[model samples]
Target chain A: MIKKSLGIALFTACFLFALCVGPALSADSVKIGILGPFSGSLAFNASEMKKGMLLALEEVNDAGGLFGRQVELVYGDTECKPDKGVGAVKKLLTRDEVLVVGGGYCSSVNIAASQIADMEKCPVVVAIAISPTITNRGLEYVFRTSPNSPMFLNGINQWLEKVKQAKTVAFFMENSDYGRDGEKIWSELSKKIKAKELAHLYFEIGDTDFTTQISKLKNLNPDVTFNIASTTEAALIQKQAKELNFVTQWIGVGGQFTEAYFKMTGPISQYAMGSSLEPTLNMKSPETAAFVEAYRTAYPDSRPGIFSSQGYDNLKVILDAVQRAGEPTGDLQQDREKIKDALEKTDMKLTQGRITFEDDGQVHSVVPSVVQVQLENCEPELRIIYPEDRATADYQAPQPWRERECQ
Target chain B: MDSLFLQQVVNGLIIGSVYSLIAIGLTMIFGVMRISNFAHGDYAMVGAYVAVFVMMWLPGPLGWVNALLAAAVIVAVAGVVSELLIFRPLLDRRTDIDMIMVSIGLFILLENLAQFFFEARPRMLADPFGGNTVDLGLVSTSQLRLFCLAFSCVAIAGLQVFLNRSKTGIAIRATSQNSRAARLMGIDINRIYTLTFGLGSAMAGIGGVLYGTLFAVYPTMGAIPTLKAFVVTILGGMGNIRGAIFGGFILGVAETLGGSYLAMEYKNAIGFVIIILVLLIRPQGLFGQREGV
Candidate 1:
């Protein structure tokens, strides 16, 4: 009876081992790491990012993957936290032993994770973290395909210079790396334009109440408010500002150029303009049109936004580099170095813009546009309103909240 | 500047009332059961999601009433089930720390479950009162906020009456005061516990719906309110209903006013600062009676 039981246990153990480990061992794929806030406050962004990444990976595999090996993705959930991001990058670089890592959503998380990649000597192609310090720090392995904070305001600067020229400006910023960098750059822009800098108010990242800050801003009552926040906080700020009947030409970073922002705020979102690297609705190039069509086919119910394009570009850049790097020489470090070298010399036209890295590892070819949320056929749609070539609609100077025609 | 100060005050009071509503629910659960239910805020998260689901079936202004009602009912039932499945089993064999740990585990589980079922995308509850503002002489506020304030007041007053005047309320108070004595007096301790949890959870649900209306709702939306609720409960004296109400208003006003006058970044820290001062000055809380008394 004991021998029979032992034999049964041995068979079950073998079955479990094969079930868990056999596939991993048998799969001859080049492992690449992708990091994002997979399961936290910013989990929605991660899902959108993943869809874009999967689309890219799918296309690559269909076209016969790099060096005849299928590309496998190892996802590390940063949860939008810096420490968590570092841990994820560490695990991806050390344990997963991925050839290269890509995709970072939060600037703070990306900044921390990039250091870990640099230390590990693995190339990390950042998809969408905009803090200038990310590339400005001069990290060799850290490369950002997305425009940095300094470049983000280029289109907005044009808008502010010509139309909707405001004399006074105030900042409603979150107290994070992203917010600080935005404040620094926009504050400089405000000074450059000879616009008087009014009260600059800051709030914590996850704070639900902005009434106090709004009240402070209302007292100063600047002509324009440069607000820096992610989707949730950004929506709340707008809603609260409207509740207080405080009206201003609210300009946001690329964070507001998402479908979720429009859906969350509804009609109140109308007239809010944001500077975006990729205006999803206003497809400027054939490359962008193709990518958007592919995205729509994959995600039938959803529209691809800024992060989606960034996610696609992140993977595509890595794949391009890998293709140039030639066959993996079996040494992990050597293969990683080869990819890093190729990544430095990358210059390709992507959906967002032409991707070309400067000496600082920052993308130099991104063309930004300012898009406004307008109610088109009773649906909130983002229409490009700046950089005249891409302007789908003229910039409409908004009426006060109480005066606006909203159903 | 004067109008701004008044606006800040009005905003504080309105927001404070919400704090009171959520804190009262948390205090009730603690008072009767001696369980520091860390999962209390997640009930509000559930309530918010429930309101979202119900609003889909019933849209428009009047639909908000139905949505709020649906949230309260569903979340109350969730509270009861949680009590039976988790707390009731641990009631006899566990320490306070164990109960707290379990509640925290339950909190994380509920949050993740919500995330799994409803993606982490922030959802808005349709405005019950179409975006309209009621103009006060000194300051103007939204009709929705005023409605939230009124609702919070009415709900709190009703709870006060239920506790002071109703038969079940008396039994609940008795159980809270001394569960063993109440049991000896032929009170069903188990029933009172279930009722308290349900009542507290219902208040949390209502608070959630109102809060969701004010701010967007998502999976982790409950964390801030839960932390604030804890601060209010502590400030009001844990398990003290009247104290929770007053504490909520004080904390709310204090935070807003402080945020206005002081640095905005330290606004949330105001709650913790109040906690420290309260702990140092009056450990029993503002209205908490002595242990033996």
Candidate 2:
């Protein structure tokens, strides 16, 4: 009689274990975690990205969903800080138990989030952070849908040589990881392009003034001033640069291609070419066209920019991987493994360009470009001027502030 | 001197004037009331946004005049409301920290409220002085900076004249000296408190309008100035009006030169380092003395 009771208890224990683990592995709703600075200083980019990602997500869910399960977006607000990002990602993985994660507008925040997601073995599809080292770390579970930071250097330097004839290059950078990366690349490549580089200028994030930096730059008088600052700082520098008359050919690097720069600087923003991961407004991918149209229709009060395109494409990459992984078979570990394997082999055409990954998980299909906002008939028109094939307008030789028509 | 050095000095003075305007208001408030009013910065931020909106609505050149006038009056009224509703009720607090905590709460409340209404994105007030510069022989300065300097000088002079010569000003100073004694001498301490707070807030409002005109106006615009005001107050001797003005110029010049010669990243450190050095020499600050002084 004692033996019979023991056998019955063991059987119940096995049943309870299965009951506990089953739903976690296979649920009717596929939980995908999205994170970024949804509030705070980066909110402008975050809002644009959220809108873009949501648009893609709705379309994906509407089209029979991923793996025949409904897609649900669970969000984590990182506030664009590294430590905050780690905490947010932890909750998303441990509490929400998200099967997939998508987001990253700041490089520092993304690097931190990816580390946490890596430990949990959760696949994170990166949207917009541009640090090259993020992919070079050899994390199998991490994939990026945006161009890396250094990718802009060669293109920018090439354009500088071919068009501008800038002999000396000056760098005004933010004192952060992405900005450091920019400084490193520009300094390294400037020698290759036979251009002399001046001492690197730096500013902390959120500083309103740049008079000192402007004074120094004007004194040194480099031919091309490469400003690797955030969107707000870029606006501040350009606005002050015009006032100070220090307008060497300004080549704005990452995170500066937002609408705010043009909106705030107005005519002063003219003739400044910026490196961007998003395809120009006239890029003819049917998916890009549809995304832009839908974004406009949905957010009439807002104008979508680079983050919007990156967010949409990042979602597409993640959803495609999930679709390949198929329905959860009540084994989360097994399904996660399948999703990782499927993400490795992901190859498709999406917004911006064709979407595919290299061995290091950097998206090889996304082509970065340089775009200029010109006044055509007294209205701002964005034009792509790089790589020639995608050229909507010929690259104009950059001139000093004294020569520009805007002055 | 080279143009760069000359340019930096001019830049320093321009920034100095704005700092002086903001710090004077903060020092005045702290002088009369023991409350730190940490939300002083947010008050400036609110004023800046109000100024921006006024400019947007008024159209063309009058927007500048209207923004400044409206911001000063509106923010002054808000200060009266803030004191009556917030500080007046908290007068019987258990400790000064409670009032500080309240001010901090006000800081967060005002910042978030501005964000909620204005959105987190920065709003730029169309500057009547943007893209224009004045030739000062050795170097040129932006018209915006010149305008800011000119406005601050007028405002500071006006405030000084009022404080020195007017009946209300004397009553305010008496309350600052001894609220209990002033109350016994037939001065309405609460009325003095209300007037002082309003005047201080009006100063912040003008500072805000000028700040918004020069730099971008956003919810967090006042944070740095507010912090710098603390430094300026401590450097000038807390609650000493003249010292705040002196500290503002000193801090601004030190920051600009330090940023130029030392490093831009450590620009903020320059002011603090000076503060540390100053405290070591004069515990009372450059102008600080006894409570009455």
Candidate 3:
């Protein structure tokens, strides 16, 4: 009886192992790794990033192939958590044997994953995570295609200093590296506008309630509330703020400009301004317009937003670097080094803007846009409100809940 | 400052009522089934999804009422099905670890399924109240929130009456006290257990609709609420109905007040700390009885 049971256990163990380690990946394809929260709360954004990368990939493969070998992607779902980010990166580097990695969506996830990629000598071209610490560590392999935290709010800063001129500010930041970095940068920028800091509150990533913090803000009633949250959290915070009768001009720094935000909040999102790497409605360049057209054609149900643009640019930059670096030598270390060197020397005009990384791996040439949700033909629309040259609409002052005509 | 204090108190009680509603469901499941159902919170997620689905067909004030009823009934049916298909087989098993592992597996499965069907995007129920606020001097809140609080109170009261006055409620109570003795005494314990599971899930579903009304609903919305429910269950004493209610309210008020007066960062931590102190000081829980006494 004991021997039979032991034999059954051994069979079950072998079956499980076979299930886990599926068919081996062919060695012919050039593998690139992608890290994002593909399954958790941020899955929609991650899917957008993935779609962008896939669009870029489709263009290259359609033209023929990259260096006579088809480029394939290996995805690592970080679920926007730091510990999972570490594990996913380790798996991609060691198990998948990817040449280069791209598409780090969340700042905290990117920060954790970048460390492992650097340690493993794999080049990571970050797509959207804006925390400066990812590149400030001076890691040899870490590079950012998107602007850092300070550079991300250029348009917003210009608007605050020139147009709005707010005096008092409050902060509702998510409790993470992203939020902490946002608080630091915004606090410093607040000094330029001479806005007194009224309150700074932190909420966790998955938090759905904000009444406790919003009530406190109601008492203080700052001129503007600078919020640092993803798409969903931003919607909830603004809705709850409205619900509690705490009205203010809400400024979302670098995260809340999305299709989901508009859908979730509707008219409650009116007058709420946010900073975006690329304007959602207005296409900056012919290249951007073409990319957007191609994206809409590919994904019929969904529209490409800032995240898709980031993903598309990141992949394009990587593929461009790979082309410049010539054919792979089959030597992983030497090829990775070649890609890193080629990336450092990159100077190209893509959809968003010119992609050029400084010594710190931060993009210097790209200028972000400030956008506000406004009433256009009885519907709330995101309009470019800053950088007078690119202004689609003038910046509107804060409107009280009852005074609003749009809803 | 006085108004702020009053505002915080009102917020705490309002949110506390939600905690009580969810914890009652958790306590009922534990009290009768003796299963540590980690997926109890997913019932709320399911409820929210159902309500959102119903509201699409039925819009306006009448739509919300229909949405709440549909969510409760649909989630209750789902609970019965889950108990029959999943938990019923495990009922004969002796080890406690299997039930825990299975419940956790259920939690992951349900979350993934919701994500697959509904997508991970956060959605809001169309507020029929149209952003109307109820102002009383300095304290103000949305009319929708007040409605949710009132609904929660009514539901809890109704459950209390059913458990005390109804025939099936007596059988459930009997089974909870001594399952083997109740079974010997001609009570169909399996049917009673299934009914109890359905009732508990219905309560969680109602909480879900109210919660989804106040906040955004998505695939993983139930995760935090479930964690809070567990904390409330332990604080009120495991398997104690009255204890869960008081425990939920205390936790909600303490967390809100602590977040307001102290640091917002420690809002969740305060509940855990209180639970720790409770464990060390009173292992049987604040309102729970010593076993076999």
Candidate 4:
């Protein structure tokens, strides 16, 4: 009886081992690393990015597994710190042995991680970090799928000239890489457009008070106040601006004026304008609509933002590159180079728009959309107002403050 | 230079008032219980959330007042519960380190629970004064900030009165001075502990409400202020109320001046540096009594 029990235990142990290690050890498998701020101030955004990437992976796997090889993703949590980001990239490259690394919601963290990828000769596909310095560093291995600050700033400038016809502008930028880069881009474009810089107010990340900054802006009194900050900071600034009776036009960038922003700031978000690389409202394309529906079905609780969609597109680009590179024959370095070359050479249409990379690894073509905040039944809705060819709603600029004329 | 200096000083005072409000509870708790509650910040966070919820339900002028009251009551209840469930049981063990660890655990638990409920969104509580600025000719200040300063002064005076006159407050002070002797003299140590915890949490709640009004409310919003409060409490000498008030104002001034002159990013670092300097100069703190005194 003892001998029979021992044999049975050994058989069970062997079965469990195989069950756990079978897929990981399979020869026809491609592994990619996803690193981001999973447990810090930016965890919510990171979670959204992860969910979107996972959904894209699921779709790719369902459609025959990336050229007959199953794609695998390994996640690294950077906690939004530069040192942690560097450590995460090392772990992904050395421990997980992933060919292509993706993820990073913060610009500083992304820059740190990208440095490691460059040193290790691994391709890093960034999803939504908009610091222009990330691409400006000229790292051949680093490629960002999201539009940089220059693209968004240029788009906003064109819209202001053609659509809004605004003359002067006020700048309220956060003191971070994303905000500073955005301000620099805006400064260059404002010079070209001959827009006056009325007030240039700056605040640190995690700063709660904005009375001083708002007061300065109110005194300077420009045509519009451009809030180039995170969603939370922008919400606070906007609310303060309204309370101070500084009823200037408010324009934001990079999906800052969304449902969450409006909810946080309450009625202050009304009439705010935001520019997004991803379509905000009236997604008319059947393919885009289908993707959105699938995403909604998968994550019923969380809504997909522009960054989430960009994350999904980044994953698709990497997976497509791996599939085109064909199966690897135990040579990871060669496979990585081939995949990088394929990523640079390919042209694919994602849920957002056409995906083609420039020589510097930035998205070549993107559809920029402008959205206006409108109150519907006491709830804020981002009504698309630009690109009349694709607009589903008419633009109604908030009546100028002069016309309202408070007693 | 004069305009910048005056502005910095005003900024310091406004920010100092906030620090004093946050550190008052820490001072009270340390004075009475001799236990450093690491979860004080989490209580502040809970108060901020409660204020937000109340503000959403009640609109206009009454909203701000109700939010403050609601936060105080909710945080007081939470403090009582924590005392009954965690502190009372740990008292018999005489394990101060274990209690500190438990407080840390509570801090993390409360922060995570807040994240779970709030989903990491930073919310702006409506400024009741409508961003009205009061220009004193020399410097300008916001109505909300002036209100905070006035509230802090009132709160400090009220606390002084309570500590001096109230029977429960006397028992708390007696327990802090000599716990074993107080217990021998027929004082209910448990009740005093509970009262101290409640009082401390109430102070934190008030701080939270004011903070939410002045700034934005987020799950991790209490962390930086809490750290600053710790520095203030330490510099003030643990258990010294007046010292805490002085330390808070001093640290605030130092931070503001540092930010204005040196670098804004290093504002938080100034508090730590002051704490280190105090530790090196006077190990017992600026206002602390000598050991065995």
Q: On residues A154-224, what C-alpha lDDT tens digit does candidate 1 reach at each position?
A: 78987898887689999988888999989988888788889999888888867888999998898898999
Q: Write the per-residue lDDT of candidate 3 for residues A362-391, one digit (tens) a residue.
A: 788987778888887656777888787878
lDDT of 4 at B117: 72
Order of models, best DockQ first: 3, 1, 2, 4
* Chain A TM-score, structure 3: 0.92
* TM-score per candidate for chain A alone: 0.91, 0.88, 0.92, 0.85
Question: What's the TM-score of every candidate structure?
Answer: 0.94, 0.91, 0.95, 0.80
The superposed Cα distance between candidate 4 and the true structure at residue A307, in angstroms, equals 2.0
- Pairwise lDDT winner, candidates 1 and 2: 1
TM-scores of chain B alone in all candidate structures, in the order given: 0.98, 0.95, 0.97, 0.96
Q: Write the per-residue lDDT of candidate 3 for residues B130-229, one digit (tens) a residue.
A: 7688878689888888887787888888988888899888888898889999999999998998899999999999899888888888999999889999
What is the lDDT, from 0 to 100, of the residue A331 in candidate 3? 88
Which residue pairs does candidate 3 place in steric collision?
Answer: none
lDDT of 4 by residue, A83-193 (tens): 898898998898778888987778888888898898888889998888887877888888888888777766567778777766788888777777778778777777777
For residue B179, what is the lDDT in candidate 4?
A: 88
| Candidate 3 wrongly placed segments (more than 4 Å) | A1-25, A279-281
Tens-digit lDDT track for model 1 on B1-293?
A: 59989999999999999999999989999999999998988899999999999888888987889988998999999999888777877788789999999899788878876887899888989887787787776687899999888889999999999999999999999988899999999999999999999999999999999999999889988898999999999998999999999999999999999999987888999999999999999988998987897
